[model samples]
Target: MTVTADRFDDALRAGPRVVLQTPEGVPLVMTLASVGERAYAFTIDCLFAAIGLLALLFLSLLTQFAGSSLFGAVFVLAFFLLRNGWFLAHELRSGRTPGKRRAALRVVDARGGPLEPLAVVVRNLTREVEVFVPLVLLANPDFVLDQGPGLVRAVGVVWVAGFALVPFFDKKRRRIGDLLAGTLVVREPRHALQADLVAGAADGEDSRGEPAFEPAQLAHYGVYELQVLEKVLREEPTRSLVLDAVAEKVMRRIGWTGDPREFGGARPFLAAFYRAQRARLEHDLALGRARQSKTAATERGSRPSTMHRNSQ
Candidate 1:
């Protein structure tokens, strides 16, 4: 019943530890943005909205458009665009609004894939209902307790409280919109991680000879296990004891045969294994059968073989 790291391998999958798995199956670990962080990002976005509103105001003044019916219609349209379209346009195009990017956060699917249009629209539109409307109603002096209907003001208070409180109760710190839309907000991964993993593994002396793994050997484990091996190999080569022990553990897990001592050295065995696994992952990706974690792989296996490779 024990869950191992290989149990789930969607690298870009969001969690407390954000793991961004590339198309080639390399994983870059990241951290999830906190609720406080999310608030800061939102505040930054509000600043952008404010600036947009100011621009519209300036345009109205210069064009003598203020106080005219035409200006009122234009103002409403601009508000809708700056309020709703701002989030929709930015999230759909790049998965990050200006606020999110400044906060080093990006939105992704719960399963660690790219954001889809439906999800983007749902989350942002819901924000209007859950956040904007209630705030505007409550904050407007015309709608205050002494000036407006008691029932309406009371309803506004309750609506804001409920929606704003949902995130605090969820384990993932998900807002109501995020829960409904199946989305998560997480920190962006460091840019250098990919280069470090690939570049270090590519040093000529590390994996000098051509890999000699058989098809069966390569099939025993998928990208998840290969990533674990990569981490081990990337450790200091002079730490022979650690390398040997990790290599032996990996071999046992994958049912790899032959003595480590006979394969030049533990480091070489690891390097060659990495080469084979990476090559296999690349081939599988090209075949449109990209490697998934144990759970996804099992689910995939249960489906009919006639299913196309791209479906995986």
Candidate 2:
């Protein structure tokens, strides 16, 4: 088969993506974060850290009369803490730092599982060797030696540059920290919910109002599941088997004890469940509770569980 020019253009235009699995045996295509995006995020994080450092510097000047030894020690300790703790605290609390959040990026398990705190620590701490050490060498070559060796400084610089370039070489665009911690930085897909079926149903709808679903029952699923349901509902009505399977899963989740047949059919049952689930999700969204998926880590999260799809 001859490849068309359009196909070649499409291939060239596509960015790097990795395929992960959902618990329900579905395939999820995750887009790797671009170099430009990562750099943007890193710059933002550094800016925030710099602001804190500047504040501490001002405080040190104010307390200069308190003796250089006391405040000098405090300055060093605070510098180290602010420089690293800023990243550790934010990442441990939520996989994404303020920078990652603003960039719409996240760190996920490379092996397709929940991101562990240990992994977060490992990745963030690598900044010491990967970034900090290199920066010091560049700025002050004699950091290690009284008269920093020219060869040694050059070697350090090259090593750091190599680390910086690792992502360009890796198929997944994983850098040193990500490779060591088995994590990946993925960009969240910007997916908007389709036009409100629940609201539209208010006028001509008949199947969704019969069975009342409780908040607790409706809370079993999240935006991810809701989108999947929406995808199904938009297809041709003849795909009854697909609807039946999806409906069964929803019933199991909501602990629907009533018969599926009694609800009329898969279409009606799914419609009712959809209405309840949408209302539940909307309420949560309004309250600033973002549940990307059922298994998504909570602050313990994802959008980039937008890393947490449906899986292990």
Question: Highest TM-score: which candidate?
Answer: 2
Q: lDDT of all predictions, in order shown?
A: 0.71, 0.74
Root mean square deviation (Cα) for candidate 2: 14.7
**How many times do residue backbones clash in model 2?**
7
Stretches of candidate 1 exceeding 4 Å from the true structure? 1-15, 18-29, 141-156, 191-312
Residue 9 in model 2: shift from native, Å?
9.5
Q: Which candidate should be chosen as best, given lDDT against the real structure?
A: 2
On residues 1-312, what C-alpha lDDT tens digit does candidate 2 reach at each position? 011222223234546788877566767787889888988998899999899878877876796733677777877887889788988899888888899999999888877777889999999888777777666766776774445567876786787767767888888888889889999999975777766667645765565355788878977766766766765776628347877777777777678888767767777778778887888887877787746666554454454233243323
Shift in Å, residue 179, candidate 1: 0.6
Model 1 C-alpha lDDT per residue in residues 1-312, reported as the tens digit of each score: 012233333343544664566556766555678888788988999899989888989988998888689888888898988988988899999998998999899888876666779998888888986677567656773543446677876775786667877777877777888998998888885555454444544566554454467777777665555665665666446456767776777677668787766656777777777777778887988887755433457655442221222344
Off by over 4 Å in 2: 1-14, 59-69, 144-149, 196-312
